[model samples]
Target: MDVDFGGADDILFERSGHAGIVTLNRPAALNAVNHRMVRALTRALAAWEADAAVRLVVIRAEGRAFSAGGDILDIYEAGRAGDPPFDFFADEYRLNAAIARFPKPYVALINGIVMGGGVGVSFHGSHRVMTGNAVFAMPEVGIGFFPDVGGSHFLSRLPGGFGLYLALTGNRIRHGDACAFGLATHSVPADDLPALLRRLCETGDADASLAVDARAVAAETEDAVMDAIARHFAHDTLDGVLGSLAADGGEWANAMHATLMARSPTSLRVTFRQIRTGATLTMDDCMRMEFRILSRMLVGHDFYEGIRAAIIDKKSTPHWRPAALDAVAQADVDAYFAPPAGGDLSLQ
Candidate 1:
């Protein structure tokens, strides 16, 4: 058992009244999840699930941002040192699944940059509260990876094809937009989060802890801009999306077209298929597929090149193998869905 929870506090856990609280604590790293953190969190959550005294779990972070994602530098270094980076995703995905199926109230006070692995943990909670400082995105495509962490399952279900648009563009989700997209169930002011946490810990009730008066968030994703988005991103195929955007002469369309062009061609194609297929599958199913895809990505060229450009070298320019979307063959994308080298995730 990796239950030496006291020895690992990168993800801090505590009992407050009838509530179980977990705080992501690596402020300097923006609480980016590492392998130990994942293990610590999974153990804590499982323990909380077995403890009848706990009626709710509160997930928050102590820093400027909730979490940037999983530790990318760790993956890059592991590859450099010729070590396999497998346990992090395997455990992280298990934690994600645990969050999704948690029986008690799971509250997330997301009050900062929340992206990638951050979304994996927070979005699956029963109540996702976006604060004034909250910002969200799934930027996997830019790094030659598709949106994992149960994104394919939930993002595919958002209103008006907004989910697909986000998956493709890697755009930021901010403020009221979080509520509008149903990504957040409540919006609270950042300054009031401390008091809210107090109330939640005291009462172990999400509703009793949250109110709309000073914390209301209102956003409009319905605009002329969305019309163009709906027209282009609604296509089931990445090529179809590109074709529509390429034909449209609108300035916004042109910019978005260019945005798609900049992403990893393989990532985009695989993600396009990922979200569409994920819509028909369960969360666990989506995770299994993601595990398969990520296992393949680890051994591929673009993942390493992406890590080099985006994190290691700080160049922000990745030379994708299949540089253009048209260059990606169906067989190439299909291979990502094959059985993982480590076998399927052992969630049990």
Candidate 2:
């Protein structure tokens, strides 16, 4: 294994033939991506791009989970210390942009719990391989944050308004369901991952691995589910979706209502706008928009409280600032969309 770029080994990079491999090495922490990891990743990506021998890249984690998420505990402490989380978001979003615009073929092994920041790394890659253990989700709303890291761009493009539902409710999806929802491209079982990686490394191309026997994670949809999603989430307003859920008597509707009611009202309002307005924008635009929202959210009351209740205290109950959903007004939500303090995020 070749170690380069300041010799930080938390995010390991190596060259084997024509492929560059990245191993996330924080098993004890569920391979959570911190700013240091982000910096290491940034350096590796740039180095590989410049290296002539590197034809492809593969990113996999060394724990039960591919990644838990960004270091929320760090952010929680930052909040307590009266420090702003500006630098973390700035770098993390830049890394997401790098992944999105990477020239070479990028392959991600989605093995275990893949959520939040994990999605930014894997979801934007050229190839996303999900195994039996893969559990995909974007639960930022539960933490009083909207799905950033180009979420607005990708989620908005998901078929049948389902992105809106996932963004609001933070539902979990398995490997099969992930493929069906455009989150994964292949569903190779866990036992076969080693051989698949070997072939990918050997040929230095994803096509070689794709040619091998594996289940293609096709984007197939059920009519009933799509219809229900449309009925509830198609509406432009969160209140409309809530009204639809309340009117419907099915278990699915009831469950979704409970989840939505439990989420931060301001977050729901902002996220609803994020995904909806973001659907029409490019990936770069979506990231820029997220930067604005995140800047506002950092100083707000809900993010810290949500982190305290969910991570620190384990209470799982966050009394959102706007206690009632309807209390969040259009003006309140619009304030987050205003230009960020440091100016918009630039991929350059």
Candidate 3:
């Protein structure tokens, strides 16, 4: 059944037999999440979790992209109005945590362009299924923000140094790479998804029907290219990572270098520290850290400018504050991760 929150159709929730489905409905902006969607989703999930009739929760989107990300336009407006950026982040993180620890089985159908907040909602699922066209990344660094929404938790868990690499470079991973990188559980052809989902809905034992041999799935789809990801992404700093890639002297290495070079240097540095610090953090600590950084960003970091240049203005050339990775100071990066003046995030 569909639920309405005011006039905004930000989220659509429906139930079919034992299956409860949540759809991100903002197709025009690639289903990019805004505040209303987050709140509606949280409410819907709470309802479904309490409903014994609902055995499974499937999250999908109505657009070509699963979700482009959190609504930067809202963030931009907040920054413009001089409101605390943490306000949005705190609420969003709460929703993210709810999804992560939700009692019922939650599945995410990652069809296309899953990134940033999309990852927050979809990646924590009990079963994350991707289509061949699905593209995934935590490219917050490109926009002068750290990967929030429990990215710290998952990014740190990525095998070897993959977490550090993706955090710094904002590289996009295809469905095959996503499965190999542990970001997704299954990779079925995009065309087969409708039937698979239909079968899932039709099953009497939804949980058992959705379950697949995790080991077999991993072995079959593990990305062979991850060795390169581990080796090249092992460096502590972006400079070192780039140098390693450059030294490798291959088409992939060259392409990766160009991609990294295009992102904001300040963002890259902050992202590096975010991943490193997040490596040892519990999920709670990571969320708290992200809140602190995001709060600071709302006041007047480069996030507004980055979004203006990249998304709104569509210039694609962001004039970062430091303009180069080496220009960002260690102390500045440390400050971003520091706790807010009062205390850590309040779970309640």
Candidate 4:
């Protein structure tokens, strides 16, 4: 196995015959992604795509979590320094878009926690494999920001109202629910993954055989909990959703209500709008919209405060401005979705 780019010890890259495997190497942080890791990953993928000997690329992570998410601590530091936060988002988003549209066969072995920016890298792959341990979500709303990193595109594509439900609630989808929501292609036992990867590599016909086996494995572990998800997540507003759940009076409903109450109200409204708007948008359009919202959040909103309280202060309490959901006016939410002074996100 050959390894390149020694600077990013947090990201491990190696080649096994015709297969290229990229592992997120930060186990202590649950493989959370930082700027250096993102840059290294982008470079590695580009190199593998160009290499004649590399027939496939596998993106997996070390530790119990695939990735906790993007390095929010870095974002907090940039915000505190009064730096234009758009720079980080722009670079990260560009990397995600590249992966979504990458030409070669991309396989994301989603073995554990895959959330927020984690989903951005792993979900768009041609072959997305999940294990019994995988837990997925877009918890950006909890941090007083709308979901980004192409979240608008993929979450919007979810069936029924599941997209909007997740955007606002920061709901955690387990391995079964992930398959039911179309967030993952295959669901195999965690133990089966290593052998599956080896088999796919040795199959010679990398593209066709991998796809066939991956789909079969996923179908075999199909989630029967889709009805419950659909029933709980179909409501339009947060209050309505809660009311419906409360009326049911089940333990699951109580747990879900607690989850929703813990997140930022303003973020929920903005995220709801983001997913709805994104549902009708192209990949470029989704990125552009998210970029606009995130740019504004950097300068004008309580994103810094949210990060400070939850991560820096370790308080778990975020005092959001216009704290109540009803206090957040339509105009205020509209401003986040509106175009920035410059324009939409551009590839160049």
TM-score of model 2 vs. true structure: 0.96
**lDDT-sorted candidate list, best first:** 2, 1, 4, 3
lDDT of 3 by residue, 1-348 (tens): 555643167788878867887888889999988887887787788788898888888888987999999989988877788675565677789888888888877888888899998898898877888887788888887777778889888998888787877787787878766777778887767776676677667773534554532222333323545677788888877778889989999887788888888777767777777787788998777888888777666665578878888889896777778777778788877777788776777755
lDDT of 1 by residue, 1-348 (tens): 122475266878888888888888889999898888887778777888899988899999999999999888888888777775877888888889889999989999898999999898899999999888898999988888889989998898887778899998888878688898789888888888888888887887787778632366677454887778888989877888999999997888899999999998998888898888888999888889889998888878888888889888886789999788778998998899999756888776
lDDT of 4 at 271: 79
How does residue 132 of candidate 1 score in lDDT? 82
What's model 3's TM-score?
0.89
Computed on alpha carbons, the lDDT of every model, listed in order, comes to 0.85, 0.86, 0.78, 0.78
RMSD to the hidden true structure, all candidates: 2.3, 1.7, 2.9, 3.0
Task: Point to the candidate with the largest TM-score.
Answer: 2
Model 2 worst lDDT run, 10 consecutive residues: 213-222
lDDT of 2 by residue, 208-296 (tens): 78668468654334677668987899986888999999999899889889889999999999999999998899888888899999999
Every model's TM-score? 0.95, 0.96, 0.89, 0.88
| Candidate 4 lDDT by residue in tens digits, 136-248 | 88888887887888889998888867777778777687766677668887777788788777865665344555555553333332243345557777776656776777787
Top-down TM-score ranking: 2, 1, 3, 4
After superposition of all CA atoms, the RMSD between model 3 and the true structure is 2.9
Task: Give the poorly placed runs of model 3, Cα more than 4 Å off.
Answer: 4-7, 204-207, 211-225, 249-251
